[model samples]
Target: MINIQSGIPGFDQLTVSELTEGGIPEKSTTLIYGPPKTGKSIFCNQFTYNGLSNQEPCLYVSTDQGYKQVQRDMTDFQWLIQNYIQNQTIYFIDGISHLSGGKFENKNNIVSSSVSNPADLMVKVGIGTRNVYKTSNHFRSILDSLNTLFAFNPDQMVIKILKAYLRRITEAGGTGLIAYTEGITDPKTENELKSLFNNTIRLDGQHIHIKSDHPDFDEVQYFESTYTITDNGIVVNENNFKNIN
Candidate 1:
């Protein structure tokens, strides 16, 4: 099976290697959900940096912040993606730019577009993906914090849009990582959304759990793996914290 190596060392060791072929499964989408401040965004940043480092083009859709903020955040973590941005290997769809004084003047001529709503986001994503595909056949996309989309659109509408968009990612031979926040929806609604993805990475505070239909995964052994976010990225503790539920 095709796979892409996630840059985070601990994630690759504790989850990726055990669940898939030494990395995230290619042509499939993985949902990353967790409470706020649990390093979900950091995980995504690390993944994108890894992809860019490997010469895989990336499309990052930001529903919560502008592309500059994302750049600043990653830079703080010492994951400098500015070079990728300059070369157009990494593209962005900024959904919050309109909210914050419209689109900021992009002096770098980076491959990014601004969207005001979910409808616009869909259109921009389609355009963004097509553009990125021109750079490489194998690419990755990330939707940072799906919670913002849920806040503005009906649950069903968001799910419908996400499902279609995710399918497009897979069809184009690309992998996707969608970050989501837990406790925003009821359990039933949450489960429904989770069911759409090929894999689920749940971050609960300092503990993380991965669930997949792949038979090789030993659910009992991998449950509630402990981790801490450092400047480099996620660092998984060797001892699993079984009681952190």
Candidate 2:
């Protein structure tokens, strides 16, 4: 049986099975990169929310959408994360607020940063995640999209920052996911990110593709599946998903 499952229906049963045999390996990081409107945010939400529901401490680092907007998105999708926030099972790091003229937050589980590189954002995440580790031995984290940071910092600088923080997660024995916005960061850099993360997946319309050269994954595995954004929460054709190479 898969030990750690992606909350998405077809996902855990297929690609993760194809890639890792088991579910996403613990103490690892996966990159979910793609253009907008392709359910990237929902994918991350589903992962973190699943961990939270399992009584595992979860940390959400929002670089693109602020925590409130993520909350709204989860609400629209009917995942309902507010209770997790209320009980502190889930901690949040908001990186978009200060850039948008909002004040910084340092108190409570919901912390805010000044919208900077992973160095600054990492500090906020480190603080919140450290707290989560106080009582829990395992956790899952997500940096919604690093594309926001890439827009300002040099790709090399951004890459170094991500490498350092991801190493931190590995040392702490937690799984992480960092999303990438399609077509914004250069293709060369994107390829570098694919190499760095080792496990990378692409979200395109109703099609999800996995691209990697690792021995564990072959070339571009694509899956045809559908999803909903309403109170239907999330729906996936788990049993009928078609895998096309």
Candidate 3:
């Protein structure tokens, strides 16, 4: 049985046993939640790149940044860019524009101009829409940012998109990591989405918490890892967490 491990080197020393014990549950979905600048995206990138290095194709659907920007950011991590990112084992889909519903410049003109033909308007709307469809059928993992979707519509509509996305990934026999910002504070909404995931990881400053749905596993565990932004990537120093039981 292949063990699911965090891509970070020393960090795996903290989570290897648990992940190897039950094989990290096949088709598992995890949510990494944290406030802004709390290393959520970095963590997502690590997982995606790790899967790629393992010869597992990974998809990174970005709702916040463009393809070029993401590439530029990853350049800081030499290993990431040279080993996996540049090798095309990892794919990127920019969905940031979709989160805005439609382009503001295009919508303004349509609204300002007295175009009475609803059909024409519908066509124009469709033309302005941005849809990102995956080309590859086999992907071992997908990392998507939920913050953009929530910014688009805070209603139940976002939930529908999330469910569809998750279903697509799992149906393809791949694991996925969906990230949500800590801004959404409604417990009911959080729980509703949480039920869809097999695992949930929370990041707060330097603290990391993992929660699993399986009863036999440690449902809740904490790690005192220093979340540092380095040139190579986001490094997690788990040596300080002696009480990680």
Candidate 4:
């Protein structure tokens, strides 16, 4: 009853009753790992939308997509992307400039940053997170993808940046989600990330798996679901996926 509802379609349903009763734990970091086109980004968007609906301060760091594209995609799903953008409750830290290589534009609740540089990313996240912390009592954030970060920096450097970012979120006692593309990063490298993040969700094609390694986790902490990623969002059709439990 006290857990943070994912607000993701069928995610809670796929998990058993305990998860729905408890929801996603606060101050927890979740990794949404999957192959290319596995719906990780849409899940992040839905999670942010859910936070906005709950009036929770939200931060969206676009590491892979441009601001305009993100807005357009969210609009297609009928989310009022601009309303939240204008309200200042949900902020977007633009990482597109790092990819597009243009002038940075910082506006109301919109932070433009050079995420290509590891040091700049750390500083930008620090500043943006601090600003959100100062104003909002509780907030949720999504770092769109670790793939871009890993692509730009060496494995060791990316790990350091990730560690710092996670620490900031934990210190703020906020919930966070960081997604990564599976397969591209070697198992040994990803294990380093898995060791740091408590909750792991893997999407291999249509199959879905979720495991929680939180301190309070019990044997029943694992679950699965079958879902389809569509233009709207992820659609969960059944409670049990593959009966892997």
Candidate 5:
């Protein structure tokens, strides 16, 4: 299995390359769940930026905010998505535009399409994913916040569609990250949603806990570390998180 570097030095060190190469395993989907303001979005930004820097095509499906805001945030961190946008290496599914009655417009060379409804999200993402694959079969993607869809649709429906969509991405040889709001669902519901991914990252303030499975390991492996989000992205004090179980 191939692994793509996560771009954050601390994440690479904390997870260790032996297990998953200190990065996200290629063609696998990872779930990122945490409370609000816990750096989940920043984590997604860093991952997306890493893919762009590596010339990997990326698809960002935004349900909680506009693609413009995401670009603005990446700019504030100096990640720079403009070049990628120009080159068409990055695509976005703006799930907010239709909700606002089409007030949003595609600016510059930004490649984006709006979803008409929650169910249409799958179609929008498929379009973005196919477009990215045109540049490279190996790509990266992120769906920002599943909670918004859950608000309008049934939890089971969201999970079922998300499972199918994530499976399609992986089958097409793409790695994906999904951001989900914690505490919005019961334990059973949360676990059920998390079950759809190959790996899970749970964030608590500056602390992060990761759960992953390796073919060589009989059981799942768990790791945790504290980190700070900086202008350069996530910063982990490599010394603080050596205990891996």
Candidate 6:
């Protein structure tokens, strides 16, 4: 039997039953998809921070901005640089440059190989390394903002990239949450990606709907949670949740 942990407080109360009934493991792949400004990034940050607070190592892969900018934004959530971020157990990989064919090491050189798949790029960039591990213990988590990839076509190259990325994380016995914005409007592509995930979480408005692909589960559950951006970070009011089981 696999035990899945809901990173969100109060939110877990509504999900625990379904997760247990489905037997989804702890170190599994979760997809959080929604429109822009729906608190996707904040949710990822909170999930990552939860792991860090538990003395678990986490890797945050950002395709939209550099590490410095993310760090700055996180500071508003009461996340101190020296205490919670800098040289800590949480590691950040600034993947924004990699999208524009920029070299990971030398910012000057233009990368000849364009990597559409983030999972492959993660390994190429040495994300799973001792240096990355030096920061925390949980040593397992991923947040890939999928907006960058939608710029290209939904071809096998894209699928291969996602597959490679998820495989790397799962193989290492780590769990991950990949974020996808509502850009690639093609239903076929969306369905294909959905097939790859073990669980799918949609943040629509102020509600979070969760679904699992496990055979033991056949129903989708909805929960109400408040989304707020504050100085201390994204605070989710899980206690006010009501399950749509």
Off by over 4 Å in 4: 17-22, 218-220, 239-245
What's the lDDT for residue 167 in model 4?
92
**TM-score for candidate 5, residues paired by index:** 0.92
Angstrom error at residue 140, model 3: 3.6
Tens-digit lDDT string for candidate 4 (1-245): 24677877777666655434534667788999988988888888888888888888887788888777788888888776687788788778888665676766688678777557767767778877877787674788899888888887788888888899999887986788998898757789888988888788888778788887677655537777778877678876674554344
Window of ten residues with lowest summed lDDT in model 4:
14-23
lDDT of 2 by residue, 109-226 (tens): 9887745645777777677768777747688888888878887778898888888778876677678888888887778987888788756777776556654334344554454455
Say which prediction, candidate 3 or candidate 4, comes out ahead on lDDT: 4
Q: What global local distance difference test value does model 5 have?
A: 0.80
Q: Total clashing residue pairs per candidate?
A: 0, 0, 0, 2, 2, 10
Question: Against the true structure, what is each candidate's TM-score?
Answer: 0.88, 0.85, 0.72, 0.91, 0.92, 0.77
The TM-score obtained by model 4 is: 0.91
Tell me the deviation in Å of residue 149 in model 3. Answer: 0.4
lDDT by residue for model 1 over 110-229, one digit each (tens)? 334433366767877877788888888799999997888888778888888899889877777778999999988778889999989878888887778876543344442234578888
Q: Which residue segments of model 5 deviate by more than 4 Å? A: 106-116, 214-217
What is the C-alpha local distance difference test score of each model? 0.78, 0.73, 0.57, 0.78, 0.80, 0.61
Checking candidate 6 for backbone clashes, the offending pairs are 56-138, 57-137, 57-138, 57-139, 76-231, 77-232, 77-233, 89-135, 89-136, 119-165
Q: Is candidate 4 or candidate 6 better by lDDT?
A: 4
Which ranges of candidate 6 are over 4 A from the true structure? 1-7, 18-25, 81-88, 98-120, 125-137, 152-155, 215-231, 235-240
lDDT of 3 by residue, 1-245 (tens): 33465575555554444434422445677888878887787777776666666676665666676544666676557544444544555545555543334442322111211112223322332222211114244445544577656665654766766676667666665677778888674778878888888777778877766655644455444344555666666666766543355
RMSD (Cα, Å) for all candidates, in order, is 3.3, 3.0, 7.8, 2.1, 2.1, 4.6
Q: Indicate the worst ten consecutive residues by lDDT in candidate 2.
A: 211-220
